[model samples]
Target: MSKSLLNHILLLVLLFIGIILSLSLGSVSIPFKEIIKSLLALSVENSTWDYIIVNYRLPKTITAILIGSGLAVSGLLMQTLFRNPLAGPYVLGLSSGASLGVAFLIMGAGLLSGILGEFIFSKWAIILAASGGSLLVMLAVLSTAQRVKDTMTLLIIGLMVASLTSAVVSVLAYFSNSDDLQLYIFWSFGSLGNLSWQEVGILASCWFIGLGFAIFCLKNLNALLLGENYAKSMGVELKSNRILIIVSTSILAGSATAFAGPIAFVGLAVPHLVRQLIPTNDHRILLPSVILGGAILMLICDVIAQLPGNENTLPINAVTSIFGAPVVIWLLLRKRKLNF
Candidate 1:
């Protein structure tokens, strides 16, 4: 068997292990055997364990998998599109756009007690606002992509938009009450366990559609690694491909941010980690490897965030950034440069 194939198998094994660990080692520890039974829809001896396993852990695990793979794939898309090591899924200001929408909804909340207020303050409102904000940015980026001849200029435009939105958010925060500010702050910390099955289903739909776009652009992505001129020479339409890349990224990153509240670092780190492991530039290999790597990393991070049997769970964003940064730093130091 090829070495890459062997590595892929190993990653799959790690993912399976991570899933089991995530399911079995929560605040109330469930046994591996019971987890397996619950997964298979078999009755467990303990009803409480069964309920926890079937309802909470199952959905959360799926969420981790989706968030990880989506962000990682989005990061890979951004990195390849920009041909920059430092570029991340949020480079196009998608996350900032999301934060902007959510900030307005929470900080500018004019509603207090009525049904309208309840609807405005509901979780769905946050999700809607975030999605709306991301879509606005996506449209802006798409329009900009069509007009700009230089890719670097598009990146700069995205940064400017992000900065502008952040400034607006700051203004809103300044005018907001303490309670609203605290709510916004907590939202930024990110979460994985809060998703319902319906929300998970929505998240998965976004993942699938985004990944479908990624798969469609696989060849364009590979050709892009050489250079835009090379890709164009190979008959890749740069403008259309660029829009698709941005769209895919916006979908993946935007959905994750909207639902999970802007969890950090996974999109930026997973591709690099997978590249180091698999040592390939081929998108066919890179995409799947990054998917598995991202999922496993997220599952592990989620498990760590849960603090395993402790009632106190860390924020998902905190755990990802806290642990991911050091590993990425060590990898770069060891290699003395980025692989890309």
Candidate 2:
């Protein structure tokens, strides 16, 4: 096999190892043998260990993989569309917009009861509210993208929307009850543990749809990298392609934020890592690698968030920022600056 193919295989193997390790490592540690046994019995019988493994750890692990892959794909799409390596889901303020949506539900609607509520948001109402908020922002951004011709202008507008959303969230927080405020604060910190199986299913479905759409647009993305006029010269319809990319990115980023509460750095950093590994700009290769790289990074971050030594788990966002920020800085300082 070529070195590149060999490396990809190695990475996939490592990712599988990471998933298994994540399943085994937690507050209540289970032996590998028991974990394997539990999986075998999952369909045939019900046991205490089976419930724990299937209901709890399985969902968390699946979420980590899904969110990681979704965010990474979103980042790649944005970076390609903007022709800016630094353009990530978070950088464009999509996460913040999602946060703002959740904030409104947590603060204004007082809907904090249900599966997530027991540990976190704790309510279906909050989840719905947050989803609504994110959808609204997605629509707004999509509308703006339709009107604006310049990619940089769209980015600036996104930033402005994010800032406006943050300002609103601040005002809401200022007036919110202390109990609600604390919940909001924790939600903002981000966690994979917040998702239940139903939520995981929703996330998985959305991710699959978004990824499928992204794969279909690979050729257009490649054409885009050559510049808008060049793409047009090649008979690539800019308007429709742009809309599809924006919509796909919005679904991926929005779902992740609504569910995971804006886990940081995975979307922004993983694509660059994949690019470095592959040493090619081809989206066909880069897209799949980005997904795998994202899943691996998120699994690692989820393990760190649990932190076996500590009674208190670190927030998912905190762990991501600790690793993500440095990579982002390096990308910014690289020889070829992102023009968009």
- Tell me each candidate's RMSD, in Å, in order: 1.3, 3.6
Query: Model 2, range 78-182, lDDT digits (tens) per residue?
Result: 998888877887656777777787787778755544434454445565566567777887888888878988878988988898899999999999999999889
Candidate 1, residues 1-340, lDDT tens digits: the string is 9999999999999999998888888888777888899899999989999989878999999999999999999999999999987788999889889999999888878653354557877889999999998889889989999999989999999999999999999999999999999999999999988788899999999999999999999989999999999999989999999999998998899999999988889998999999888898999999999999999999999989988768999999999999989998999899887778
Score candidate 1 by TM-score against the native: 0.97
TM-scores across all candidates? Answer: 0.97, 0.90
In Å, residue 199's CA in model 2 sits off its true spot by 1.6
The Cα local distance difference test for each model comes to 0.91, 0.82
- For model 1, the superposed segments whose C-alpha errors exceed 4 Å read 111-115
| Candidate 2 segments exceeding 4 Å error | 42-46, 110-122, 327-340
